[model samples]
Target chain A: MNNKITQNLYLLPYALWIVLFVIAPLLLVLYYSFFDIEGHFSLMNYMNFFTPVYMKMAFSSFWYAFLITFISLIFAYPTAYLLTKTRHKQLWLLLIIVPSWINLLLKAYAFLGIFGTKGIANSFLEAIGVGSKQILFTDFSFIFVSVYIFIPFMILPIFNSLNEMNPSLLDAANDLGASKWTTFRRVIFPLTINGVKSGCQVVFIPALSLFMLTRLIAGNRVITLGTAIEQHFLVTRDWGMGSTIAVFLIIIMFLIMSVTGNRKRGV
Target chain B: MSKLVRFFFAIILVSAVLFYTVHELNNSEGYSGRNTLTIYNWGDYIDPQLIKRFEKETGVKVIYETFDSNEAMLTKIEQGGTTYDIAIPSEYMIDKMRKERLLIPLDHSKLPNLHYIDKRFMDLPFDEDNKYSVPYFWGTVGIVYNSKMLGGKKITSWNDLWDSDLRNKILLIDGAREVMGMGLNSLGYSLNDTNHNHLHQAKRKLDLLTPNIKAIVGDESRLLLENEEASIGLVWSGVASEIMSENKNLEYAVPKEGSNLWFDNMVIPKTAKNIKAAHKFINFMLDPKIAAKNAEYVNYSTPNKHALSYMPKGTVNDERFYPSPELTRKLEVYENLGKKNLAYYNELFLEFKMHRK
Candidate 1:
C-alpha cells in the first residue's frame, strides 16, 4: 500500500500536465465547436463543414499531403538504406539530420532565394540551355520544399529499423540462392514495413496540416486544412468553424494513427 | 462496457473542472504597474528610433509587439488576455472595434496636437468625429509596374491587368478586401458591396484575370516586383513608393476605375492600464516634425497636414505617393461589413483562390 502511494505521487506531475495542457485544450476546442460566431450554441458550424467548398479543400489538402509523403518516402528509403552500408554510417546520418535542426522558416526562405527568377536554379537551367522557368510559387516548389523538410523525419525511423535488423538474415538469404533484389523485396522490406509505416505517419500527418509552406512557397496558390483553420480563427474571427475543423482533424489523426500504429504482437 | 462507461464519466468530470478553471483564469485581472505601457502595431509600420524616443521622453517602459494583419491584431485584442494600451488598426477594423466596444474613446484634452491632423482625413466614416481613433498613415491600393519590363505598355487602369500580352505577368497582393475590391472595382461596384450576386459576379471576373496572375503573395509581392519576376503588381501605395525608390523604372498608379483608400489609426483599447501614457505617446506621434520623420522613414502618406512642410520637397509633391485631392475624393474607404458579411467575403475570396488551381 505504501509502495502504491509512492508510485501515484511520482505520476502526479505528468498526470497534471496531461490534464491541464493536453486534455484541457482539446476539451475547450470541442466546446468551442458547438457555437456560432455570435456565441450562440448551434450546430451551424458542423453543418458548414459538410459543404462542397470545405469538402473540396479537404480533398485537395489530403491529395497534397499524400504526394508529399509518397515523395519523401521514395527519397528517404534509398538514403536510409545506403546510410546503413556506409563505413561511418552514424556520422553521415547525423549530417543528414543537421539541416533539419535549422528553423523551417529559414529553410523555406532559402528555397525562395534559390528557386527565384534570378536564382541559382534558374541560372543553371539557363546555362544548360533549358532556359529559366517560373519555379517559385509553383506546385513543384511546394512539394520539393516539403519533401526536403520532411526527409529527415522519414529517414531516421527507417534507418533505425534497418540498423536494428539482424545481419544473419541477409547472409541466410544469400545462402538460399536469393538475388540481392529478391532478398530486399522478400526479407528486408517485409521486416522494415513497420519503419516505413512510422516514417509515413510522421510525414503524412504534419504535411496534411502545413500552413506556412503553402503561404511562403506556394504563394497562397494552395490552401490546406491548416490554412483554412487559421483563416477561420485568425482572419475571420470565426473560431467556432475553426474549432469544428480542428475536431474533425483530431478524429482523422486518430484514424490515421490506428491504421499505421504498431500492432499488439510484432516481429 | 462498464469500463467504457466509466471512462466517459471521468472525461465529463475532467472537462467540467477544466471549463471552470479556464473561466476563473480569464476573470483574474493582471497586475499593471503605473510605469509600463504596451503598444501593439503592424510590423515595420513605425520607426524604431521613435519608440526609443517615446520611452525616453515619458520615462515609461514600452512593451512593443507587432502583428501582420488587422484581423490578427483584432483577434488578439478581443481575447482580453493582454492589456494593450495602444494599437494601430486600419479604418474598417476601427469600425469593427467600435461595434464590439473593444476600444475606449479618446479624451481630446489629453491630445493637444490633434489640431495638426489634416481636415480632409478627420471625421471619416469609420470613426466619425475621431472618437476612438487618430489617423496614423493613409494610402490607396493600386498597381506598381516596371515600365521597362512592360515594354511601353502603360498600366493606367485595372483593365490593363487583363491584357492577353500580360499573361502570367502580374502578382496580386494577398488580401481578401484588396483583391476582391479589385474585382468589384473592375465591375463598377462598391468594394463593400454585400450583394451575393454582385460578389459572385466579381469572383467570375477575377476568374478571367487568373491567366495573367502569376501569384498571390503578401510582403514578397514587393520583392518579386523589385526582382522583375512579374512586370506588374497589385500592391499598396506605400510598398510601391518604397520599391520605386529602389528601382527608378517602377511607377505607381491609382487605377482609373477607383480603388481602396485605407487609413491606419492609433487607438487605446478598453483594456488599457496606462491611458495617460498612451495619450502622451499619441500626442508625441502627432507632432509635425515627428510625423514627418515617421512618414519619410515608413514611406507612407502622413495625415498631419502641418507635417508636410517639414517633409522633403520631392516626397511631399509626388502625386503618385500622395494622390491629388480630387483623386483622393473618388477613392472609397472600406466599411465594417459586420462579422457575417466579412466572413462571406473571405469565403468568396477562398473560392476564387481555389479556382486558380
Candidate 2:
C-alpha cells in the first residue's frame, strides 16, 4: 500500500498538468461555444454552424482527413514491414524517423521550395521537354506534404505493433504450409489490427485540424474545420463561432476514436 | 547518486520560479516611480531608436508592445487586462474604434506639429476632422512586376492581370479585402462598395482571374517574386519599394484603376493613463527630421509634408513609393465596413477562396 501510494504520488504532477492544460482549456471552449462576443446567452453560434456551407466544409475536412490517413497508412505499413524484415532494423527505423526531428512547418516550407514554379520539380519536368507545370498552390502538393509530415505518426505505432507480433504464431502458420502472403493476410494482419486502428486514429484526428498547412501548402483551395475555426477566431474575431466549430470537431474526433478504439479489444 | 542530482535540480527549478514570480510582481509596481507610457503598435512598425529618443527627450519611460493584426489589437484593448497609452492602428480600424468611442480626442495645442501633415492625408473619410487620430504612415496598393519579363511593356491598368500571356505567372495578395477591392476598382466601382450585387460582381470577376493566378500569397510573395517564380505580384507600395531596392529588374506601378491607399494612424485610447505623453510622442513623430528618419527606417511614406524635404533627395520622387498625380487622384482608402458588411465580405470572400477554380 505504501509503494502504491508513492507511485500515485509520482502520477500527481502529470494529473495536475492534464487537468490544467487539457481539461480546463477544453471546458473553456465548451463554455464559450454557448455565448456570443457580447457575453450574451445565445445558440446563434451553433445555429450558424448548421448551415449548408459549413456542412460542406465539415464534409471536406473529414474527407481530406480520411484521405490523408489512408495515404499515410499505405506508405507506412510497407515501410514498417520492411523495417521489421530488415537486417539492421533499428538503424532503418531511425532513418525513417529522421525527418520528424525537424518541425512540420519547416518541412512544409522546404516542400514549397522543392515544388515551386522555379523549383526542382518543374525544372526536372522541363528538362524532360514536358515544360513547366504549376505545382505550388495545387491540391497535389498539399496532399503530398501532409502525407510526408504525418507518415511517421502512422509508422511508429504500426512498427510497435509489428515488432510485438508473436513470431511463434507466424512460424506455426508457415509450418502449416501457409505462404508468406497468406500468412500475412490471415495471421500477422489480424493480430496487428489494434495498431492499424490506433495509428489511423492518431493521424486522422490531427489531420482534421491541420489549419496552417492547408493555407501554406494548399493556398486556401482546401478549407478544413481547422481553417474555418481560425477564420472565425483570428480573422473575424468571432470567438463564439470558433469555439462552436471547435466543439463540433472535438465531438467528431471522439466519435471516430470510439468507433476505432473500442472494437475487438481482446485482440 | 542520481536521486541527489534530481533533488538538486528540483531546488534550482523552484528557486528560478520564485525569482521570476518576484521579478514580474516588481515590474507591475512600476520602475522606480518614473512616469511610464505604454504604446502598442504592429510588430517592427516603429524604429526602436525613435522610442529611445522619445524617452530621452521626455523623462518618460516607454513600454512598447506589438500585435500582428488590427483585429488582435481591438480584441486586446476591448478585453482590457492591459492598458495602453497609445496605439498605431490602421485607418479603417480607427473608424471602427471611433464608432465604439474607444478613442479620446486630440488637443491641437498639444500637437502643434499637426500643421506639417500633408493636406492630402487630412480630412479623409475615416476621421474627417482628425478628432481622434493622427496619421503615422501611408502606402498605396500597386503592382510589382518583373520589367525584364515584361519586355519594357508598361503594365498600368488592373486589366493587365487578366492578360492571357501572364497566365500562371501572376500572384495575387491572399487577403480577401485587398483582392476584392482591386476587383471592384477594376470594374470602375468603389473599393468600399458594400452593395450585395456589386460584391457578387466583384467576386465573379475575381473568380475569372483564378485561372491566371499562380499563387495567392501573404509573406511568401516576396520569396516567390525574388526567385522569379512569379512575374507580377499585387503588393503594397512599401513592399514594392523594398523589392525594387533589392532587384533592379523589378518595377512598381500604380494601376490606372484605383487601389487601396492604406494608412496607419496613432490614436490615444479612452483607457490611456498617459494621455499627455501620448500627445507629445505623436507630435514628436510628426517633426520633420524625426518623421523622415521613421519613414526611411520603415520604408513607408510619411504623411508630414515637411518630412519629405528632410528625406533622401529622390525618396519623394520615387513614383513607386509615391504614386503619380493621375493615379493618386483615383486611389481609394478602405473604409471600416460595420459588423454586418464585414461579415458579408468574409463569407463571400471565404467562398471565393475555397472554390479557387
Candidate 3:
C-alpha cells in the first residue's frame, strides 16, 4: 500500500500536466466546434466541413502529408542503417539531431535562401548547364524542405530499434545459409516494424498540420488543414469553424494511431 | 529510485504553484500604484523616440507591445486578461471591433489634436463621424515592379499583371482581402463586394492569373522583389516604398483599375485601465511634428494634413504613396463585411489559393 502511494505521488505531476495541457484544451476545442460565428450553438461548422471545398483541401493536405512521410522514410531508413555501421555511431546520431535542435523557423529561412532563384541550388543548376529555374515556392521545394526537417525524427527511432536488435539473430541467419537481403527482409524488418510505425507516427501528424512551411516554403501555393484552421481562427475570426477542423483532425489522428498502433505482442 | 522520483515531482509541483502565486501577486501590485499606459500597435510602426517623448511629456510609464495582425490584436483584447490603454487596428477591423463593442467611444474633448487630421481621411465608410477611431497611417495596395526586368513595358493597369510575358514572374501579397480585392478591382467590382455572383466572378478571373503568379508571400515579398527574384509584386504602398528605397530598379504603380485604400487607426479598447493616458498618447501622436517623424521613419503616408508640411517634399508628393484626388476617388476602403460575409471572403480566397497547378 505504501509503495502504491509513492508511485502515485511520482505520477501526480505528469497527470496534472496531461489534464491541464492536453485534455483541457481538447475539451475546449470540442466545445467551441458546436458554435457558429455569432456564438450561437449550432451544427453549421460541422455541416460546412463536409462541403466539396473543405473536402478537397483535406484530401490534398492528406496527400502532401503522406508524400512527405514516405519521402522522409526512404531517406531516413538508409541513413540510419548506414549510421549504425559507422565506428562513431552515437557521434553521427548526435550530428543528425543537432539540426533538429536549431529553431524550425531558422532552418526554413535557410532553405528559402538556398532554394531561391539566385540561391546556391539554382546557381549550381546553372553551372551544370541546366540553367537557373524557379526552384522556390514549387511543390518540389516544399516536399524537399519538409523531408529534410522530418528525416532526423524518422531516423532516431529506426536507429534505436536497429541498435536494440540481437546480433546473434543475424549470425544465425548467416549460419543458416540465408542471404543478407533475405535476412534483412524476413528477420530484421519485422523486428523493427514497431520503430518504423512510431517514426511514421511522429512525422505524419505534424506534417498534416504544417502551416508555416506551406507559407514560407510553398509560398501559399499549398493549403493544409492547419493553414485553413489558422485562417478561420486568426484571419476570419471564425473560431467555430477552426475548432470544428481541429476536432476532425483529432479524430483523424486517432484513426491513424489505431491503424498504425502496436498490436498484441506475440500475435 | 522511487523516493528520488517522488522528491523531484514534489519539487516541480511546488515550484509551479509558487511561480503562479508570485506571478499573480506581481500582476496585482504592479499596476495598482503606478501611472502606466499599455499601448498595442503593429511591430516597428512607430518611432521609439516618440514613445519616450510621450512618456517624458506626460510623466506616465509607457508599456509598449506589438502585434503583427489586427485579428491577433482583437483576439488578445477579446481574451481579456491584461487591460490595454490603447491599440491600433486597420479600417475594416475598426468597424468589426465597433460592432463587437470592443472599442471605447472617444471623448473628443480629450483629443484636441483631432483637428490636425486630413479632412480627406475623416468620416470614412468604415467608421463614419470618427466615433471610435483616429487615423494614424494610410496607404494603398499597388504593383511594385522592377523596371529593368519588365522588358520596357510600363505597368499602368491591373490588366498588365495578366500579360503572358509576365508568366511565373509575379509575387502576390499573401492576404485574403488584399488578394481578393485585386481580383475584384481587375473585374471592375468594388473591393468590398459581398455579392455572391460578383465574388465568384472575381475568383474565376483570379484563377486565370495563376500561371503568371510565382507565389503568394507576406513580408518576404519585399525581399524577393529586392533581389530581383521576381520582376513584379502586388504589395502595399508602404512596403513598396521600403522596397523602392532598397532597390532603385523597383517602382510602384497604382493600377488604373484602382485598388484598396487601407488605414491604420489608434483607438482605446473598452477594457482600458487608463483612459486619460490613452487619450493623451493619442493626442501626442497626432501632433503634426510627431506624426511626420513617425511617417518618415515608417515610410507610410501620414493622415495628418499639417504633418505633410513637416515631411520631405519628394516623399509627400510621390503619387504612388499619396495618390491624386482623382485616383483616390477610384480607390475603395475595405468595409467590415460582418462575420458571415468576411468568412465567405476568406473561403473564396482559400479556394483560389488551393487551385494551384
Top DockQ prediction, candidate number? 3
Off by more than 4 A, model 3: A1-18, B1-35, B52-61
List model 1 lDDT by residue over B1-357, tens digit each. Answer: 999999999999999999988656434533223577899998788998998888767777778999988999988888888989999999999998999899999999999999999999999888989999999999999999999988866888888788899888888877889989999999999888999999999999998988888888878788889888778999989999998999988988999898999999999998899899999999999999999989988999999999999988999998888887898888999998888988998988888888763
Q: TM-score, each model?
A: 0.92, 0.85, 0.91
Q: Per-prediction interface RMSD? A: 1.1, 2.1, 1.0
- The regions of model 1 sitting more than 4 angstroms off are B1-34
Q: What DockQ, on C-alphas, does every prediction get?
A: 0.51, 0.44, 0.74
DockQ of 3: 0.74
lDDT of 3 by residue, B1-357 (tens): 999999999999999999988668646644333788999988878899998788768778788998877788899999999789999999989988998899999999988999999899999888889999999999998999999998667998998888888889989887888889989989899998999999999999999999998998877887889999899999888888987999988888999888888899999998799999999999999999999999988999999999999998999898878877887888888888887898888899999998875
Highest TM-score model number? 1
DockQ of 2: 0.44
Off by over 4 Å in 2: A1-52, A85-98, A126-131, A264-267, B1-40, B47-66, B81-86, B104-115, B123-125, B128-131, B268-284, B324-327
Model 1, global lDDT: 0.91
All candidates in order of TM-score, best leading: 1, 3, 2
Per-residue alpha-carbon lDDT of candidate 3 for residues A1-267, written as tens digits (9 for 90 to 100): 999999999999999999999999999999999999999999999999999889988998999999999999998888888988999999999999999999999999998899988899999999999998888998899999999999899999999999899989999999999999999999999988988999999999999999999999999888899999998888888999999999999999999999999889879
**Could you tell me which 10 consecutive residues in candidate 2 chain B have the lowest summed lDDT?**
B25-34
Per-residue error (Å), model 1, residue A47: 2.9
